[model samples]
Target: MQRYPMTPAGHLALEEELKHLKTVERPRITQAIAEAREHGDLKENAEYHAAREQQGLSEARIRDIEAKLGGAQVIDVATLPKDGRVVFGVTVVIENIDTEEQQRYTIVGEDEADFKINKISINSPIARGLIGKSEGDEAKIQTPRGEVEYEIVEVIYGE
Candidate 1:
């Protein structure tokens, strides 16, 4: 089994979503299916077909969440030593060598990556470049645009 590295927050979020799907969405979809079944002929009933399709999608999502949770290895960054090295679950501050633009990004699992919130996936180009590097180190990252150099200013854990 392939182990997925995840932060404590990401694991909890997935668990919450799974619970919501089972408790709320599953019941709602079942009710919709039941109500649709009352509308006479099943062959030509669009509502019934749509309800079934929705149930299929919801069930698939639930299974996916469960599988992810099963394979997840939650890593608590707080327990790790603060050695100033960029690693998974750490919030890293990097400054662009060219423009001097500084950005803070939290390295997280693939499922928890939200670029708008500055949570980057560990598999991402920038995060891959920053990982294992120490503070004050210059990292040259390969992005979609081209190569970019950044200075690692800080590495914070549990932030």
Candidate 2:
């Protein structure tokens, strides 16, 4: 099994979600299905159909989460090297060459990518461009909005 990188926090989050799904969602859906089955003719029972659909979806999600958690290689960001290179688990500050705006990004695993948190997936174009780059280096990334240029301002390990 190929192990993918994940932060410690990300691993914990997935574990919690998996626990909730298996304990709470699975039992609730099972109960719903049982109750629906008691309502008579199965052929025309909307409740039964809905409950079955929900059960299928929930089970699929549970399996997916389980697989991800199984293959996760959790890394603690604070333990990363203090080198100025932008790498996984490092927080990078980049200045847009054109707009002159600064933005901070942390390169993380696929499951931990959240735009709201400014965490980008390692496979993302921007993150790919930023990876292996040192402070004062420039990275050109192709975005949906076209090519954007950014100069690496700083790189912080762990914190």
Candidate 3:
């Protein structure tokens, strides 16, 4: 099976979610199903149907988390070489070549990417352009709008 590249923080986050799903959600859904079963006939019990559907969804999420965790190759940024090159689990500061607008983003796995937090997926166009590039290097990315060029201002590891 193909292994997934992920930061240690992302791995921990996934593990925590899996724990919550299996420990809290699984038991809670089981109890709801049981309670709904006691309410009335199985044929037309809305509560029972809802509970079952919820159970199915919860179980599916649990399985998905488990699979992701199992396939994960956790990389701790702190252990990286800190060679000033952009890579997974590192924060890269870049400036738009044309607009001169500066921005900071952390290169992360797909599941760990949150634009609000300035974390972009490794597969993103910007990250793909930035990867293997050191500070002071210029990267050209193909975006939906068009090709955008960025100058790498800095590369920080373990941030």
Candidate 2, superposed: residue stretches over 4 Å from native: none
Candidate 1 has an lDDT of 0.94
Clashing pairs in 3: none
What does the lDDT read for residue 20 in candidate 1?
95
Off by over 4 Å in 1: none
TM-score of candidate 3 on Cα atoms, chains taken together: 0.94
For each candidate in the order shown, give its overall lDDT on alpha carbons: 0.94, 0.91, 0.92
Model 2, span 50-124: residue lDDT tens: 999999999999988889888998888687777788888888999999999999998888888998989999889
Clashing pairs for model 2 are none
lDDT of 1 by residue, 73-127 (tens): 9999999999999999999999999999999999999889999999999999999
Quick one: best TM-score, which candidate? 1
Higher-lDDT candidate of 1 and 3: 1
User: Clashes per prediction?
Assistant: 0, 0, 0
Give the residue spans of candidate 3 off by over 4 A. none
| Rank by lDDT (best first) | 1, 3, 2
Q: What is the lDDT of candidate 3?
A: 0.92
Using lDDT, give the best candidate's number.
1
How does residue 132 of candidate 2 score in lDDT?
A: 95
